[model samples]
Target: MTQAFEGIRIVDFSQVLAGPFASGQLAMLGADVIKVEQPGVGDQMRTTMANNKLADLKLSPGFMGVNANKRAITVDLKHPDAKEIIHRLLADADVLLENFKAGVIKRLGYDYDAVRAVKPDIIYCSVSGYGQQGPMAGKAAYDGAIQAVSGMMGITGTPESGPMRAGYMPADISTGITAAFAISSALFRRTHTGEGQHLDVSMLDSAMTIMSPNLNKYLATREEPALVGNTSPTFQGTANTWPTKDGHMQVSVITDRMTATLVQALGKPEWADDPRFTTSQGRVEHADEVKALIGDVLAAETTAHWIERLGNEGIPTAPVNSLKQLMEFPQLEHRGILATVPAPPGVEGELTMTGAGFHASNGEPKVTSAGPRLGQHTEEVLAELGYDAAAIQAFRDNDVI
Candidate 1:
């Protein structure tokens, strides 16, 4: 069966995580994505996390993760010839994705209007720190900066540690997801109307959107929410990572029935009778005492012991797995969530990419090709746009490819 986006062609000018990740999802759904890069040096991520100091900067695991299933082509957009080449490619393209700062694309002469002049139905997406018309549009922002600006950092750490950036780049990842959804929606709209529109996605906006409940509560009460660490505010002390005999286990007892069951499992059912622990609100009020009591009981059992017992009792509990543990997880294997893909040539490693999140009865998502080597498809892609052999050679010789 044909993949979802079989005939779609995407001109991807996105460099780092957010834009590339969004395009990667499209590629997985069978869009033909050509990643545009600068000549000599490709994406900045190609050197961001090089393993060995003296090694060539072209090999980066960070680059490999988000850039899978796309082709790469080098182009010096600063050069007149290269600009002409990009316009020629855009003539038949379905989508154009970029992650430059606000106004940068317009400055480069490849804004939505410029692209629309060439391809009237081209879906143009711009991913930025803020957005196109905001007061902070031109302000520089990386993942950490966005986290601070979005109140994500404020709610991250424990009360004792002040504000802290999350362990991972939540802003970048969240924005990537948002961009993918927006692009997919745009593609669907294009199917109906045969018209394309510009999409402006903001990392700060995406991050703040994820924190709506907390922000809304603060607005209503005129009080800022304190950092609650691993516990969620709505769960009211019902969710947390507790210490087991072997390691830590995360447990969520959202309802009173589950809480009572957990108390019985720990041979402390009397705790459920306590007025301070009777209701969810009361539990939240005396969360520290209730947590200490639960901790004392959980510390007596090993993680494996509790896992089996909890599973049998219908309590939602799991070991807090590391990446290594997760890779070897039995359930993930059974569910076919992970699969190995060949690494790029000369990379000396293979990568484990995830399959689609959910199975489809109608059709399977395709992985057409692995991530392209820098500018690997320059000649092939340009040729598809009707560039003859001599013209392609001239473009390459001029360092305009």
Candidate 2:
């Protein structure tokens, strides 16, 4: 079976998580993504997690996690001759992706105008901290900084501890998803119009977009949303994590039937008719009392017992799992959500990583190649652009590859 994006070609100049992640998704969808890196040093992520104590330097787990199904080529864009090589690759590329700071590409003389001059149908995407323009346009920002700036930190933690950043790089991941959508949309438009466009994706813009609903609610109601720990505000009284004899379990008693079942399951049917907890609204008004009552009942059972009992009753519930437990989850395995792919050449088998997240009904997504090592395909990619062996050797001799 043919892949979804088999004929698409992407020239990727993205480095870290966000840009690379977007391009990686495209690669998973069958785009031939050629990741261009600086000579020798390569993507900063290659060495970011390389510690003396770790076994493999090139196979850093962090590096392997984000990059897959792409080829790598090294070119010193700063070198005048190398610019021609990049132009050669862009001449046939359907998309160009980069995450450099504002004006860096323009300085390198491969800005959208220059690239479009070579391939007018190229979908050029630029990812950055801020956007291409604004007061903070040139300022550098990362996931943590964007999280703080976008007010995501303010709503994360518990009320007692005050605001806190999320445990993961939500800003980066969210921005990457936005970039992927924008690139796909641009590709679709190109199919019809045969015109390419410049797409700008900013960490700040993506973070703010994710936070808009909460910010809008606060602005409209003049009511600040409090940090409610694990439970959502709308479902405060009915939703909570309770401790069992063995472990913890989260339970959601969203409907009357579920609430009734939970009350019966806990052997506290008397509480069902109590005026203070009869309705969801009434329970919210007396959330503290309801929580204390439920907590007392749950403290008597083990997590496994509660899961078996509550699940049988049709109440939505689950045990909080650690990363290791989640990875080994049976459901994920059954769904084929996790599978290992071979490591790139020169990398060890111990360096293998998980495949893409999406699944296709028509055909399995191919993992044809692993993330490229620094400058691994420099000569090969240039050769594809019609350069002979002598020209590539000369460029390498000049420290331009």
Candidate 3:
């Protein structure tokens, strides 16, 4: 496989979304990622599949969504001998990832200080709800809770809906992606400096970065923007999602040219001539009026009709697609961003997971497998560690594996 991380090894003690996603991205790039879950129960994400049918196989779609190309092993971290297993893995691992609550990994004796002792050049990353030394560091936080703390929920929904959580865990997912990016960059830095360091990634900090545009606006104005659903929060009403006769479409009126074109496309060229619509800022000030005029005419036609006409006129507009529609998007199919992998045992057909969000000239990414089953690689990995059958059986009998 022509993957970037082919020679790297990652031992991840992270659970749930953020940590798994980060390791999964590295795995997609062909890292030998060992995902260590608790014995017997495994990572909680294996059961977070919700109503999906693959829970019996211990590979939920939600789990498979990020765990492709990973080797999972179950080790009870609370056990005294767990440190030996972790040290053995870290002796060869280039990176270590964990997302347990603050101080948990350190208490378990696998923290950055301990890990670097085993491998001085190891990149150790700890993802937490807050940072390692914040007032909220000790508090338990999940995605939804972090979203609220990070001001995402406050600005996510419409004013009418009050504060609403995102449908998916953006905090967890984006944090994971950020962690992977940082991990790769850290490795690059090590190549030059011959040093490795601890990385502290906070979900709250990540959320703020995701809200940077809005946060910038707030800092400048000294006031948080009110929740305006389906509207551009930075530019206010200039960009909006309008209901077409058959469906909804988002139209961006960021520049004067685009606004004029939109007005002309609506057969209201005279509207752009008005002083209220003369400048882009003026148009933004009168955004409601602009949207009403455009949305009225747009509401008379189907989304496809508006998209075709607006696209030809150089107006930025597109049909608001649902999740399934996005999955079936022709552009995505052509781009080959997703790959279908072997179905986990007992499941039918195949499972599709996304790649590393780019194309490689050598070949496609090495995302070749689905999420690992519970303890699926435990015996195999132990054997590779020079544990004979008797020792393996003893570990199993002692409930250590």
Writing each residue's lDDT as its tens digit, candidate 1 over 125-161 gives: 9999998886999777889999998988888878898
Runs in model 2 deviating more than 4 A are 50-56, 350-352
What digit string (tens of lDDT, one per residue) describes model 2 on residues 14-90? 88789988887778778888988888777878866667532244545666566777888888889999888988898
User: If both were scored by TM-score, which would come out higher, candidate 1 or candidate 2?
Assistant: 1
TM-score of each: 0.95, 0.94, 0.95
The model with the greater lDDT, 2 or 3, is: 3
Local distance difference test, each candidate = 0.83, 0.82, 0.85
Instruction: Give candidate 2's TM-score.
Output: 0.94
Compare the candidates by lDDT and give the number of the best one: 3
Q: After superposition, how far is residue 119 of candidate 2 from its true place, in Å?
A: 1.2
Distance from true position, residue 183, model 2, in Å? 0.6
Worst 10 residues of 3 by lDDT: 49-58
TM-score of 1: 0.95
lDDT of 3 by residue, 80-131 (tens): 9877877888888999999988988878888898899999999999999998
